[model samples]
Target: MTDTLLTEPDAGNASEALHEDRLWRDNGWTARVKKNEDDDGWAVEMIKDGEAEPALVGPWTMGRDKKNPKPLDTGAFNTLVKTASEVLRRHEQQLHAQLHKRMAVESGDATIEVTLDIVPDEDDPYALLTAFDSFGEQLAQVKVAPNFKLSRASAASWVENEFRRPG
Candidate 1:
C-alpha cells in the first residue's frame, strides 16, 4: 500500500546531485507521484523506457497524515512497471486477435479451414481470406476488405463456389 524506493545514485555523480524522493528511475522504468488535478488526492504515473507517455496512471495512497501523498520507493516502482507491462502485453494480444479471424467449414467430403487476417496499412488497409484443406495445404488465398467477416456459412459457400479474387 506504500511506495518503495529502488534506485541507486549514479556512480559517476555520487556527490554532484542529490536524488529526489518524489521521482524514481530504475529497471528501465520511471515512477512519479504527483497531485491529481481532479481532486485533492494524488496520482502515480509509470513510464517505460523510450516511451513518450506513461504506460500506467492511477490514484496513489495517502501518507500517515492523510493529507500528503505516500513516498515513492523501489518496491512501488517495480510493481507499477510490472502492472504497466502486463497491460501493454494484453492490449497487444487483443489487437492481434482482432485482426485475425479463423474458422472451419464442411465442403463436400473434406473440411476446409478458413482464415481472415487483416493488414492495417495507413494508405491501403486490406484483409487476406485464405482456405486450407484438412492436410494444411493452402487451397486458395484472396484479398478482401479489412471489414470482411469469415464464418462457417461463408466458408461453406466459398468452398462450394469457385475461388475468385475478391474485388
Candidate 2:
C-alpha cells in the first residue's frame, strides 16, 4: 500500500505546509501523522485495525530537511509497527520469566524443598503464565500478553504475597 498525504485546506498555509500522511494498514496495524493540537509539531498515531483505539501515539520527528518530514511510507511504517510490537512482547515475556524464576516449592525433605513450574498459555494468546508448586498448587500467575505488561514492582509484590512466610 502506498502512503497518502492528507492535508486540511482550511487549516491555513502553515498546516498545509506541514504535509500530513497516512501509511498502510496491515495485520491490524496502521500508522498516521497529523498536526499536534497543542503545538505546530506533528504526532504519529499507531492504531490497531481491530481495536477501537490506537495502540501507540508518539511525537513524529522531522527528517534531515528540518522543514518537512521524510514522509510516512508503508515500508517504513510497517517496520516501525513490527519493531514496536516485538519489543512490547519480549518485555512481557521477560517479566513473566523473572517473576516465576525466583519461586520454588518442595515438601518432605531434610530441608524445605522448592520447585517452580511456569506454564504459558498456548490456546489463549492473552492468557497468563501460571506458576505452580511441586504439589501442583498454584503460587502466582502473570499475564505475559503484549497488552498486559507486568511491572517489576508489581511482580515482586505478587511474589512476596504468594510466598510470604509466617513469623
Candidate 3:
C-alpha cells in the first residue's frame, strides 16, 4: 500500500476573498481587521499561534477602492500574514543586531561609561533591550528595540545599584 498525501491548490480567488475581507493568514500569523475604537479608520490585529492575544496591532489603511473590506478567506489571509510576519521578523533581527553593535562595553583606567540606543519594537511595543557589563552592571538600555537600539535604562539602573558615590 502507498501513502498518499493531500495537498491544497494555491487559488487566487481564495486569497482574493480573504484580502477583500481584510484578513490575512500565514504560516503562524493571522491578520484580522477591526474597527478603531477612537477613530473612524480600521485596525489590524496580528495573532500568532499559541499566543493568548495578538502579537501586534496597528492601524490599517483602506484599499485602493477606498471602501471597507469584505469577508476574509484562506488565500488572501495567507498572503497578508506572510508579508506582515516577514516584515516583523526582519525588524526584530535588525534591532537585535544593531543593539549588539551600539552598546559597547569600554573600560578606561578606573571608570566605565554607558550609552543607550533606543528604538521601537513594533511587534513587542512594551518590551525593551538591555545590556550588562561583566560585573552585572548595565551599560545601556533602550525602551524601543528598533533596527538600531540600546538599553541605556538598564545600564543606568545597574550602575546606580552597583556604584554609589560616597556621601
Candidate 4:
C-alpha cells in the first residue's frame, strides 16, 4: 500500500490512536502522516477532536531511507497541536470579524458608537443594531434583518430617525 497507518482511537472518541503511519492523540488533537495523492511525497494532517475536517495539512519529512515518512514523536505531535490550535484561533477571529461590525457615528454633540452583530441561526437569522455613547453607555438596541447593510449613510439615517428598527 502507498500509505501505512498505526492507530486505535482519539480523546474525543476514546483514549487511543486511529490511522496513518504515525498517529498521535493528545490535547484534543490528532496528527496523522498520510500519503500525498498529488505526488510520491508524504503529507501530514492535523485534525481537531470532534471536528469533521482537519485544521491543518502540510508536507511531511522523509525518513533516513528517503522513502517513508518520518515517524511522529512527542515533540512533533506537540508542535502540530500548537500549530493546529493557532489555525483554528485565527479562523474564529476571521469569522467573528465577518459577522460583527463596529463604527463611530457623529450624532449631534456626542459621538455614538454603533455595532451590528449578526446571528446566523439556520432558522431565524438576524442582526442586532446597538448604539453606545462616548461613555460606553448603551443608548438603544434594535433587531434588524441579517441582510441589513451597515454603512455610514445608513447609520446616520438610523440615528436621525431615533434608532428605528431598520426596514
Candidate 5:
C-alpha cells in the first residue's frame, strides 16, 4: 500500500546511477570494484542506499592480463545485490530475535505465555511485557526498560505478582 507513495526516480540523478566498468548503481544498491588491501587482487563491495557501510564485499576476478579487476556487468551486479540483500535480511532477523522473547510460565490454574518485545527507540527505548492465556487472550501488558531480560524465572515471578510491572 505504501509503495504508491514512493516518488519516481529523479531525472537529474540518472547520470549518477548509470553503470560504469567497475561500478554499478541500481535497485537501491551500488556495486563498486576496488583493489583488495590484503593482496594484489581486486574486490567488489555492495552497499545499499543510505547505508554508510557495504552490506557485502568479496574477491573479484581479474581481467585477461590478470592485473585489473573485471568490469561490473549487469549479471554480476544482480548477483551482488541479491547476496547483499540476503545479508541485510539475515541481520534484521537476528536483531528481531534478540529484541523479542517468549516463555511459558505455569500458574496455579493454567499456563501463561509471557512475551517481551523491545522497542529500540533512539530517545526513550522501552519494552512491552505482555501475558496471554492458552486461548490467546491478552491478560496484561506493561511497559518496561528496553534492557530488561526476560527469563522463565522472571516470568513465573511476574505471574506470581499478578502481572504487575517489573523492574
Candidate 6:
C-alpha cells in the first residue's frame, strides 16, 4: 500500500468563540450583535458561511444591567442556530407551497389528481396545470396565468368537460 498523509479534524474548534462586540463564530455560522439603527436597542444577525446574506436577524437580549447587549455564550449560539435554521425551513416551505398546488377530484369511475405548478417570470408569470389519472398517468397539461386558482369543484368540472385547455 502507498503511504498517504492524513490529518485529524479540529475537534476543539467545534464550539463558538467570541471575537468582539458580542460576535460569535463556530461551525460555519457567525452570530453578531449590533446596535439597532432605528433605536437604542441591539440586534443580532446570524450569517451562515459562504452566503452573502444573513440567515437570520433579530433583536438581541440586553445584559443583566440592561445597558449593553448580552455577551455571546454557547447556549445563545445554539438558540440562534436553531432559530436561524427554522427561518430557513419556513422560507423553503412557503416557496414550495407557492410553486406547487395539488388536489384530488372525483371523476367518472375514478379519482384524478390535479396539480398547478407556477413558473415564475419577471415579465410574465405563468402556471402549468396537469391532470393525472388514478394510476398516475398523465392525462393532460395546460398553461394558465400564474395566479390561477384551482379547487376541487373546478378540477372535477375540468375532468368532466373533456380535459379542454382552459383559456
Who wins the TM-score comparison? 4
Compute the lDDT of residue 90 as modeled in candidate 5: 100
Better of 1 and 2 by lDDT: 1
Each model's backbone clash number: 5, 4, 19, 5, 0, 0
Select the stronger candidate by lDDT from 1 and 6. 6
lDDT (Cα, tens digit) per residue for candidate 2, span 11-124: 233212222355444555666676677776777776555445666777887768675555776666867688768766887788777544433323234122232334445665
- Clash tally for model 1: 5
Model 5 spans with C-alpha error above 4 angstroms: 1-17
Rank ordering of all candidates by TM-score, starting from the highest: 4, 5, 1, 6, 2, 3
Ranking by lDDT, best first?
Answer: 5, 4, 6, 1, 2, 3
Give me the displacement of residue 85 in model 6, in angstroms.
0.8
Predicted structure 5: lDDT: 0.84
TM-score of 3: 0.36
Runs in model 3 deviating more than 4 A are 1-26, 52-68, 102-167
The candidate with the higher lDDT, 2 or 5, is 5
TM-score of each: 0.81, 0.45, 0.36, 0.87, 0.83, 0.78
- Residues 1-167, candidate 1: write the lDDT tens digits: 43444343344543342224566766676677788899999898877666778889999999899998888766777788889999899988999999998998887788889999999999999999999989999999989888887777777777777667643
Where does candidate 1 stray beyond 4 Å? 1-20
Residues 6-118, candidate 3: write the lDDT tens digits. Answer: 12223433333223355554555556777777887767677665555765677767666666534456755665667667877887898676544433334443344554344
Off by over 4 Å in 6: 1-21, 50-52
Better TM-score candidate (2, 5): 5
lDDT of 3 at 130: 51
